[model samples]
Target: MQLHSSGVQYKLHLCLSVTLELILKILELKLMVVIMIKDWNVMDLVCTCVTTLLLVLICLLLYFISVYPENCGSYHGPHSINCLITIWEEVGCKIKGLRYPGVLTNADANTLKIMNLRNVKANMESVKSAADGGNADQQLNCYGIAIPNTCDSHNGPHSVECLTSIWESKGCLSEGTKAPVKLNTAEKEALALLNLE
Candidate 1:
């Protein structure tokens, strides 16, 4: 009632502020889950990490919009804003891994092609089988994939959990190697040209 009495613009500002706080809290919770969950299996880790990433991206977008509402067109209603957030979340998921639920997100039909490692794809089936067979050695190897000590090793799936079932079957990660934190010079230049520079 008090908020309504403050008039439309004031009410909208209040609402947006409240919404930002809520979104931040939610993102914090997701981050907490990402770190707190111990004894995670491949499936659990993949889903949780992807979900956390999407939430983090959403939070960033919300913060930006709250700070720069003028950047959005006047015609955008609450529904449009919701749709935009949903789309961004999906994009974040795709970047992090397969696009959730199911389907080959990267669109490369061959798992080997998606991974981009020679001989790994052909050997994927065998590796997956080994991973699935409770090969502790393979599971331990997956740890290397998780942090990836070197950039040279970072060329495959977005996450170890993103690999196909066959690939994940081996050593928790199968063939999923971490992607690099920093992009190559060409990729950086491309983004810069787009003004994401």
Candidate 2:
């Protein structure tokens, strides 16, 4: 996915700076209220404290209302300020819409396509017939040659399981070429980029 421009980061920083300034001002105001109440009786002190706290709450509410849209996007669902803050910290800005489950990256989407093709090929009538008969070796070789080529044709990297399937289907196991349960660093990284790890 294309990343948003640096304006997002700039706005985030601006919001944070504004929030910090507000907090400092609120602290100063609280200190002033406490200091200005020198001769206040117990009830007066209680009322002053309550009024100061309500003012602070109102200021914070207004501050959140001002920044919520820029930071939280158009999500209408119930959400906490803490959730918005967490999204800002983790993802730079609002996600823009409802984040459905099982969100996939581009590579992951391609891998899933390849996987669907592989599944169809593996479950074909010819392969089923070969399995039923004594032509398993022939079928295996055909798939071993076809599957990897199909994956490459789609420009998708193979996972460890795909590599192992290819190796075994090519009769490498019978020829004493042990199948690998893991791939090398570069191959693993390629698969990881597709989220097939």
Candidate 3:
């Protein structure tokens, strides 16, 4: 009876040992998986950082390229001033034909008042002509303080006032404010000879 009891005790000990070993193995597996996930996260972060840096670099490069004087192409000349004038004149022409929402529109009234303040009637006329001629390039030059297409519509009195205020602030018809009517350069020689300080 003593021998039999001892043998049973030995078997119970063996079973406990086996269970402990199994638990250890499972724990090791879980640790390995956790380590692998951490590694993957690190790699993902590194890739994202690289991509962001590359995008920033690309944007900076594009900005520099756009502003470089050498990239101005055939428009490089002292007559650039004259060219600008011509472009604005063309755009003024186009704006003339645009249909306003109402003859007694607040936008029209505001535009008239602003124009009177700036004495911008001539410039506006030129811009209208350019727009009417379907000269897209000229129209682009007429931007910055000029009446946008939205102004032709009667949005409201607030919009009209806002637009007029912006135009006025740009020195449109103010005395002693000379409107730019000429291109800075007329030809390659003029550009090369220009003393841009």
How far is each candidate from the true structure, as Cα RMSD in Å? 22.1, 16.3, 28.6
Task: Report the error of model 2 at residue 19, Å.
Answer: 2.1
Best-performing candidate as measured by lDDT: 2
Q: Compared to the true structure, candidate 2 yields what TM-score?
A: 0.26
lDDT of 1 by residue, 75-194 (tens): 223223323223323322222222221232334224323232223222433433443345534323322223222111222323322322223334444323422224455543443332
- Report lDDT (CA) for all predictions: 0.36, 0.42, 0.39
Model 3 scores what on Cα lDDT?
0.39
How do the residues 107-182 of candidate 3 rate in per-residue lDDT, one tens digit apiece?
5434443332123335555554564354544444333223345333212222433343434566564232232222
Candidate 2 structure quality by residue, lDDT tens digits, 1-197: 12233465565566667666765666676567668865446446656655666676666544444333233332332433333334322432112212211233555334333433223223333443442244534334222223333233212355556655556766777344344454567755555345111
Sorting all predicted structures by lDDT, with the top scorer first, yields 2, 3, 1
lDDT of 3 at 48: 60
lDDT of 3 at 196: 16
Candidate 2 residue spans exceeding 4 A from truth: 1-13, 37-166, 177-197
Better of 1 and 2 by TM-score: 2
Q: What TM-score does each of the candidates earn?
A: 0.19, 0.26, 0.22
Give the Å error, residue 194, model 2. 14
Where does the lowest 10-residue lDDT sum fall in candidate 1? 143-152
